[model samples]
Target: MSSFSADTPHSSSVMGRIFIYGILLIVAGYFLLPLLVMVFTSVKSMEEIRTGSLISIPTSITFDAWSKAWSSACTGVECSGLSGYFWNSVWLVTPTVSISTFLGALNGYVLTKWNFKGADVFFSMLLIGCFIPFQVILLPMARTLGFLGLAGTTTGLIMVHIIYGLAFTTLFFRNFYVSIPNELVRAAQIDGAGFFMIFWKIMLPLSIPIIVVSVIWQFTQIWNDFLFGVVFSAGESQPITVALNNLVNTSTGVKEYNVDMAAAIIAALPTLFVYVVAGKYFVRGLTAGAVKG
Candidate 1:
């Protein structure tokens, strides 16, 4: 009876684990199935795509669609492909991410370590920026861009992203820094470290996880931004997302699903790569940042 009781609990635990794993597998498949179908479609020839099922494996795979999507696909008058817009996104995202992350870190350090008068009120006001609807600011932003002579320019797009992105980045860094021990900052101050000195020497190094989180968050948001890209940029300054839209919507020829899928895959690769590489730090940062000091 003792042995049976012990065996019964073990069996129940095993069954519970199996049930959880089964549910996880089902959820994973639900998300991955679309990706699998997209990959299959991207590799298949247009004829095969049209005749065969979306989930069907291609009898013969071709990379022509990928090549075309990267090098020769049309977007409006430009038939040279997404290469330019891809680079445009790179240009826009690189600076925006760097600036936003740095500012967020700085803001966080000040808000937490410095703790001047009305700091919470200031932080609260800044947090409000995050909740403001993008639509509400679009017209004002456009006019502001025009006033600043940055309308329809890459610079304009960069400014727009930076402005909107600051709130979230600031919030992230603030929350993360709040969890850090104040003793560290106090000790640094006692040792004669000024604001920038303490920040450069102490805070910045410890902020790696949150910085990674902030960078990935900002990069993903800025890279995937379509509304701002389409509205703020024009001509050669348009980002990849806008270009992809134009490529997909161009009415000159039969809709090429393969090319569209390839372009989408290409467009999506950078963010995916970033996440895959830094996802661990991202999750760790979230957990660590959630802790209150």
Candidate 2:
């Protein structure tokens, strides 16, 4: 009976593991199915795409669709392709991510380490921005950008992303900073460290995890943003998302399904690459302060 009981528990454990792994694989396949279809379709010719099923592999693979999508695909009346718009996103994301992350780190350092009167009230107000809908700020932000002479420009889009993204970044850093022991700041002050000195020497050096989190968040938000790209920027200054929209909807003699799939993949590649590279760090940063703040 003892031997039988031992074998039964071992069998149960194996069954449990199998059940969990089965569920995980199913979920992964469900989410990845669309991406696989896109990749398969992007390499297939129009003839195969129309003749074969949506999930069918290409009988003959070719990169002509990718080539055209990158350089010659018509987006509205222009056929300049996504190369320019891609670079526009690169420029916009670079400055916006850098400036927002730094400002968030600075704000977080001040809010947590340098306690002052009305600081909690200020923080409470700042959190409100996180919940505000993008549509609510559209008209006001447009007016503000117009007054600043940045309307419908890449610089204008940069400004909008930085300002709007501040709340979340600051919130991330503040939570992280709060988890840090206050005694560290006090000890620095005892050694004659000033605000900027302590921040540069201590906070930033230890802020790697949260910094990764902030960068990924801001990068994804700014890169994938369509509404802001459409509404705030125009013409040559438009981002890749807007360009992709125009490419798909632009009336042509033949609907280039393969080219459309290729363009969509191109537009999504940056964010996907960022996540693949830094996703683990992102998870670590998010949990760095979970217990404390």
> lDDT: which candidate is best?
2
TM-score of each: 0.90, 0.91
- In candidate 2, what are the lDDT values of residues 75-102, reduced to their tens digit? 9988988999999999999999999999
Candidate 2 deviant stretches above 4 angstroms: 1-22, 284-293
Return the clash pairs for model 2, or none.
none
Task: Give per-residue lDDT, candidate 2, residue 46.
Answer: 94
Best candidate (score: TM-score)? 2
lDDT of 1 by residue, 82-185 (tens): 99999999999999999999998999998998889999989889877876778888998899999999999999999999988887788888888888999999
For candidate 2, which ten residues in a row score worst on lDDT?
284-293
